[model samples]
Target: TAHRWIGRAYFFAGVFPAGIAVLGVAPLSSTGFVSQVGNTMLAVLWLATSIAGYRMARQRRFVEHRRWMIRSFALTTSIVLNRAWLILFVILLLPHVDTTYGGDQDAMIRAAAGASAWMSWVVNLLVAEWWLERGDARRRTHRTGQAADRRDAA
Candidate 1:
């Protein structure tokens, strides 16, 4: 299927290059040292989640694979969230720029970008995990209910 093929291509193209870029380019980033570290951590988690998903699929652990893949997808989409967070942080920090950052716009932005970068991926991954857990709980509850019904009928 085209969707699967596209996903495979993304895994190769998007995931690998992102990991490589963070390792090779993050150190050279002007966003400050802490942001660089955060970027590196995000990259590492992205690659790790992707690899874990692929391995789980190969090992026939479909549920684990699904969870990992969802996590990977959430991380991948964090770029979009990062942009949104950047905007939100910037707007919220505007009034504080003069007071909190000593009138340094660059410093304020650096703070905003750093916070957004970390929050984007971390929050996304957390939400994904929470959603997946809720789904699993719901399925377990439904299964238990069905089992009870069958026993009652017998």
Candidate 2:
């Protein structure tokens, strides 16, 4: 379908470049292990999920393809989620924990930043897995009920 191809094009063109910029270039401009590692982790995740989705599509597993696509979308959104978390941490949570790390602002910020970076995609992927599994379970249940209904009718 056009929709699927569009998604593929976007991933290949838009997302890949942005991901490269973030993972490859941002670290060079910034000073810290967290950004470099975090960006790399996210880029790796994106690449893995994209490949999984494409493989599913190629194998004619439409349902699995949809599931993988959902997972890929979730991972993509994680970048925005990470920024949102950082903003929330800066506004509401960071002040309280500011004194924990010997009141060193930079240390506390780095810790929070690292935590948020990991949490963002990790949580998104977990939620995506749950959603996919839940839908599959429902389909199974529905199919089972239909079979029982047919047997009773016969």
Candidate 3:
């Protein structure tokens, strides 16, 4: 179905950014050739997922289509959350934690990065769900109005 394809597309879109971030965060020299190969394979998978989703959307599968699109949106949003968390961590948590040996900075940064990523995903998901719900409500209202009008004419 078209919806299914769209969902696939969205799913893949999210995977690409997450994959890149994960790979980038890993120490390149530490992993060796195997890491490089793994990264490449991840990239390939992201591409394939996105293409499939696109194809499904093109087929007019709105249900699956919206699902994937929402997923993609969520995945792309991790950067925003990551940055926000970093700023907050620096402003609020940094001063409270001891900076001896740079341990505090490292810990704060990691925590912020993780929290931000999670927050972004959650916020995006909620927003997408709300929009979809509102749309469905409007459609129902419209249908009801039309039925009332028809009844009046009859």
Candidate 4:
């Protein structure tokens, strides 16, 4: 469908290019190995999920496609959530924490940063899966009720 094409286009033209730029410009020395690896892992997940979603759709496995697309979107959101979480960390911990970035960052700060980077997408996907399962349960209940009603009427 048109939407799928648009998503693919955005991924290739916008997200992919921007990520490559970030990788190119990011100072690995400042980000540290864990953070850098997290970034790369997220980028790969985003691209791979997008492609998987597209392939699922092509095969008419709409349920699987929806799940994959949800995952892809969640991964894409990680970039935005990463910044938001960092800001929140600063706001809440400013009294006891240093907000500066780079090699001199404390162990707690680096741990939080790396965890946030990974959790941004991981949490989103988990939440999405929960929501989807809840929705499906509701639909099944509704259908069961409808069937029961029909049988009673007969």
- Which prediction has the highest lDDT against the true structure? 1
lDDT of 3 by residue, 10-74 (tens): 45555656666665653452334433444344344444545554666778776776665554454
Query: Please, what are the lDDT tens digits per residue for candidate 2 over residues 1-154?
Result: 8988897796788667776676676466343577558767888778777778878988989888888789888888998899887777666646666467676777667766776777788899999999989998999999999999999999
Candidate 4 least-lDDT 10 residues: 96-105
Ranking by TM-score: 1, 2, 4, 3
- Against the true structure, candidate 2 reaches a TM-score of 0.83
User: How does each model score on TM-score?
Assistant: 0.91, 0.83, 0.55, 0.74
Tens digit of lDDT per residue, candidate 4, span 16-111? 776676556444625556776777777777768777887898898999998888887887788788887767764555455444433444654666
lDDT pick, better of 1 and 3: 1
**What's the residue-level lDDT of 81 in candidate 2?**
96
User: Per-residue CA lDDT of candidate 1, range 1-154, in tens?
Assistant: 7956876777788897887787788677798876788788888999999989878877879889889999999999998999999999999999998799999999998999898888999999999999999999999999999999999999
Off by over 4 Å in 3: 1-52, 98-103
Weakest 10 consecutive residues of candidate 1 by summed lDDT:
3-12
Candidate 1 root-mean-square deviation in Å: 1.6
- Runs in model 4 deviating more than 4 A are 15-29, 98-108
